[model samples]
Target: MNRFLLVILFLFFALGAFAMGQKAVVNLDEYLLSNTKSGYTNVMVEDMVFSWKLQGQDIFVKIFAPLEGWLAIGFDPAEKMKGADYIIGIISNGAPMINEHYGDNPYGHKSIVLLGGKDLTGNKEGLENKDGTMIGFSIPQDPQDNFHKKLLPGSTHKVILAYGADKNMKARHAKRYIIEIKL
Candidate 1:
């Protein structure tokens, strides 16, 4: 099908889902193509096109990227991808996993801890595609210290994007991309 048709269909289902309590993950490809005149700057890194929107004192973050292995988005870390607050996701054994990690320097304190949700990794909510998977979650404007730092509005935060991080051992993100944004 044509891209336009795909996006229209996506919006249809997504709107229905939103009516139910859960919001939908906006596909990166479709969003970029449709919103050519958007106010937000384009944030496409590697195979991932980051999409974000503000709603009710919360910021919704989504990563639509092909998962050859895994993809991650880190917030305010000590280094590029070190000692950061991360939302890491992957398909492990046919099961989709979105994990919340607290990054510690020297790669020794990487812990899979809770990020203020019942599930450590903000619920597994997103869409999957042949090109890649769209893994998404949300963070409050003002988060607790467990998330490493407070994310207040009008403040800028630096995030590192990485693909193919080793899941078994301490996460070492490859093909890392770093960028800063203001909420």
Candidate 2:
């Protein structure tokens, strides 16, 4: 039984069976997108920006790495807000279907826009890359959710970071975290 102690007891049970089939961190924070969106009461997921135009100077940014918390913008006459939040829902092509509590006067709705708010748990602030590596958010960008602007000029927007209020979430995309913008 001494072949180097049987390969060190089979590499200690194969690294304890790969750490018990991994997946812990509370099921990866219950599959991100801020725990399935809606009017985040106070979950505080500060920033996430994904701008567009690469071969042309306007390549705006933000998004450093698996960030899943900090967002506290406001307005909810019934769009409601509470814990377990993070909701962005915009769908505009032919306009008129704005829901975040009466949709304001934003008029046209450009390809789904709904970035959530409320969750400043003691003001921590994490994601920030500064000069280009993305991850930056000092808020401000909701001019009535960026008023449509020809359904978003130079477009290619299809973002989803959910949980806020679920709404079936279309099979939930395992919690939805896809921010790819090319405006």
Candidate 3:
């Protein structure tokens, strides 16, 4: 009886451990596909597709552009590219990298880290295929940074989307678009 009880207790603990290990992991493809199907606002500019959704206090964004270079989105530019916050995504050696940037001038931007700001992005994902490159990430609606504009739901804001010709970020964008989106 004692041995049987011990075996039963062990089995119960094993089952509990197994359940604890079953955490959900979301990959880049899953994130884009799931959100696309679940009411993400999608806009097509030329050959690029920009999708965004606001969940709770954070906004998730996905950009798909037909280029092998860096893709970027700028929020609430004061004029041209000035006074805006930017998120740039690149795939290097099959790994995804996301960078936060602040628009320093009408034609240029610098990394947020260089300007003494933190990277307030999460859940970054990227994929490069024969068709195009797709990148996704999430950021808080109010990042509380001087460089970043406050993004509010139900408000319309101007956004800039661009992509380079190659993986070099310093190179000029091959194509650019400016449009207004309602969050």
Candidate 4:
């Protein structure tokens, strides 16, 4: 009787596992056929573009621009940005991180935040919140530590206003305005 009982238990567990496998197969098929962006709630497939903004603009989600300040940008983490990249224009610095066209490319890396029901493909370089909000400042790869320190944890703005840098590692000679983000 004990052996019979053991056989029954084993069969029950095997049936449960089989049921789970069937459910997984159904969900996978639905995901690939679905059109709505699930915010990456499903699998971690590569090379998909998702975009959102803090404030709406023709370009990226535009942030605050000031006469005596700099451009700051922020966005939501719900956007699945697997293949997307960002480009930030600066008011200061010659943009050593510029592209072949000598244009500023601040977000050359993937900046997707995986909160708010999203999964991460690659880690982004900035502050991320559990609810999928991201804040990033457009600065050169080698900037004064003061600049980075200024963008510490609780800062409300993401970009700054200033002038472009000169050949001497100083942004004192050029007028720079514009922070562009490519999705």
Best by lDDT: 3
Which scores better on lDDT, 3 or 4?
A: 3
Put down candidate 2 lDDT per residue, 31-149, tens digits, no spaces: 23442342121122333333222222222122222323221122221122221112222212312111222223222111122434222211112221111111222222223333222
| Candidate 3 or 2, higher TM-score | 3
lDDT of candidate 1 over 94-144, digit per residue (tens): 566777777655453354543343223443665544456666677666666
lDDT against true structure, model 3: 0.85
Quote model 3's TM-score.
0.80
Candidate 3 lDDT, tens digit per residue, 30-149?
645776798787788777888998988899888888867899999988978888899998888767898999988998999988988888989898988655688889999977868777
TM-score for every candidate vs. truth?
Answer: 0.66, 0.25, 0.80, 0.20
Q: Which one wins by lDDT: 1 or 3?
A: 3
lDDT for each of the candidates? Answer: 0.64, 0.29, 0.85, 0.26
Per-residue lDDT of model 4, residues 1-183, tens digit only: 699999999999999998876522213234333412422212121211123222221221212121222222222111221122233223233121221111113422222221112211111222111212122223222224211212222233222222223223223323323223323
Residue-pair clashes per prediction, in order, are 2, 31, 0, 16
RMSD of each: 10.0, 14.9, 9.4, 18.0
Least well predicted 10-residue stretch by lDDT in candidate 2: 128-137
Query: Higher-lDDT candidate among 1 and 4?
Result: 1
